[model samples]
Target: MDESANKMNKFDVLGSMNLRTKTLLAIGLSAFILIVVVLVSFFIDPTSITTDWSIMNQPPSLEHLFGTDWMGRDMFTRTIKGLGLSVQIGFFASILSSIIAVALAFLSSFNKYLDSFVSWLIDVFLSIPHILLIILISIALGGGAFGVLVGVAFTHWTSLARVLRAEIKRIKTSEFVTISERLGKSKFWIARKQILPLVISQVIVGTILIFPHAIMHEASVTFLGFGLSPHEPAIGIILSESMKYLATGNWWLALFPGLALLILVLLFDIAGENIKKMLDPASAND
Candidate 1:
């Protein structure tokens, strides 16, 4: 009875907290889980996952947690490695995309014509299907990790750029910015001193949100044989190879890796939304 009362009190205390506290907790939890996954992947040896014909086509069990594929490699190990690679690619791509967004957003602040052009460019990129663009770019760049990275980076910047452009436009009309302009501060100085700090939170949220899309698109292109090389232990490659053997009752092949990919995406998404909520002035007090 005492333990039950204590548990109830704990739950009540948790339930009483404001939204901002919950948001911070959620973001921290998601980041921790993702960091652990990446760290674990670094410790895993490539040779440990090599094919072993003796255990080929095994089902999930204590001995082989996610089961063995036709190549007799551990699905868990492969999935972890693939996820690490995807995370790395997503990180770099999202950073690059954010940089692109910041540059274009700043450029748009220079004049009305540049702002109009930037708006038009955003619309043009938005109209094209992302997967199609990523595939084309990946293939054109010789169809490998670098190709996928560049494709995802370039294609994902449009939405963030549009957001930042609007933000910068609003910031430019503020009293302090006008004062700075009148005080002979250069455009660059005004942007660096007054604008960048205000928009940085948005940039961070945008980058986090872009991570899932980047990972999924990278996996999709690789699965379709246009992103990563087959030899690489990518989740896409694992899923692509699993398709051939699913007919033979090898259900474990696709299931585990797909679920891992989904979970990783969800972690990024959850972290992004919560961080956005925490940073947003309108919602921060909720």
Candidate 2:
């Protein structure tokens, strides 16, 4: 290669090792841990235990790493179960939201009238606070984990739609897209062949970025008695139950679950940031 070309390629590679990509790698480690926690919980009983009141409320003893709740249930077990439930809600809801966002984004580019209408709809959705909308939807749907999933999915689509729309608009004007248009390719053909591939990385980044939000929001709503059913073995439900005993000096009741949530959220957040950097055209260009 020419010296200039080689130099440019080196610069691009160095820039691609950006903050966002590094963050994504860190987040991936968290995801692996979270996955192991879930698998263990599924294979072994999250609720199975011969209660040992002697271990109750102990702080990180070798015998009981996370200690025991007031009910003598293993805090470690409950933490895994709660984290699993929260992750499930996050995963499903984020997938649904990403699909909705992608469809609306393409629809916005399909026709001018549809574009205007979709833009307006996106604005309307964006104007609402996601948490409140999620709560309202939960109540409307009778307030359960199912409701929380649907609620968060619906409310979560707006920002993604906006991002995808902007990204789509950019993609549609690129050289290959222009060339395809000049050659009389069908809109669907151009979208599939020229547009979708270009914007896919952004979509992936958006999906990952929203996952933690969905999980946290689901937990929050459930904890407040609006998302997951109380009887369900969810992290939020366990947290809510633990809150009542917090003043009784049984702090381990809530501490483990909360820490689990924090770790998972931070991991996903960093991963998403990294994916964005890796996908950035500006960095790639540089």
Candidate 3:
């Protein structure tokens, strides 16, 4: 009895550690970066601090970190705010896109015609230029972050849907799924007891990978003046507005925001890589 108890305890510990250790690490790093950025943005001056004379492209200095813009607004503060907005857009867009993709995929499980139509739709979207679609959607949505959200959500789901469809198709054929069906299990019962448990990790992995793409397209759309409005302080808007002041030798406006965008993208990419590794059983077990 004593030996059996010890064996059970050992198995319990290993079972708890059997999954997601790597994913947690990536998530932790990205979460830390996101938290730090949000905390720092809070202390930034939210309004214009520069006088009229200080307007139109002041270089970086003691008071102005990223320099002053053409309107004499604090560029540094605006940049920070813009970044915060981008993250918000990315987070929500990714979540919504993932859900839609997963749902569409799950629906395909029920109908052959629906599966073919969904697959064709994904192919069509994948054929179009994501940036152009974003611009068009942004214009139709009346511009700014609403447009950004529309654009990102509209364009972000195609690949995710494809990925999820593949996941579901593969899961449906697994032995557990087959066994459930032979036992006269309900669709929901099979999905809940077998399919979901198996495909959930892959779905999560795809979700993380979608984030960087969402942010990249969002920034591109905004930079083209079709995303978040100029004064609302999104990174793309800042970059767009920075063009007029480019000759003033105050390059920090565009430069800093661009770098921030880069860092954020890279952070997401790293997070995705870690997630992929963790979700791959061959790697996760090691």
Give the best candidate by lDDT. Answer: 1
**Candidate 2 residue 218 C-alpha distance from true site, Å:** 0.4
Alpha carbon lDDT at 140, candidate 2: 96
Between prediction 1 and prediction 2, the one with superior lDDT is 1
lDDT of 1 by residue, 184-231 (tens): 999999999899999999999999999999999999999999999998
**Tens digit per residue, CA lDDT, model 2, 95-114:** 99999999999999998899
Candidate 1: which pairs clash? none
Per the 3 Å backbone cut-off, how many clashing residue pairs does candidate 3 have? 1
Give lDDT: candidate 1, residue 126.
Answer: 97
Say which prediction, candidate 2 or candidate 3, comes out ahead on lDDT: 2
Each prediction's TM-score versus the true structure: 0.97, 0.85, 0.85
Give per-residue lDDT, candidate 1, residue 146: 98
What would the per-residue lDDT of candidate 3 be over residues 1-286, giving only the tens digit for each residue? 9999999999887667634764686678887997788777666665644445546577888888777877777777777777777877888888888888878787787678988988888889999999999899889989877778878888888887887788888888888788888989988787677777777887787777888898889988877777776667778777887777778676787898899889988998887888788778787776
Output the lDDT of residue 225, model 1: 91
Colliding pairs, model 3: 56-70
Query: Model 1, which residues run further than 4 Å from truth?
Result: none
Q: Tell me how far the alpha carbon of residue 282 in candidate 3 is from the true structure, in angstroms, after superposition.
A: 1.3
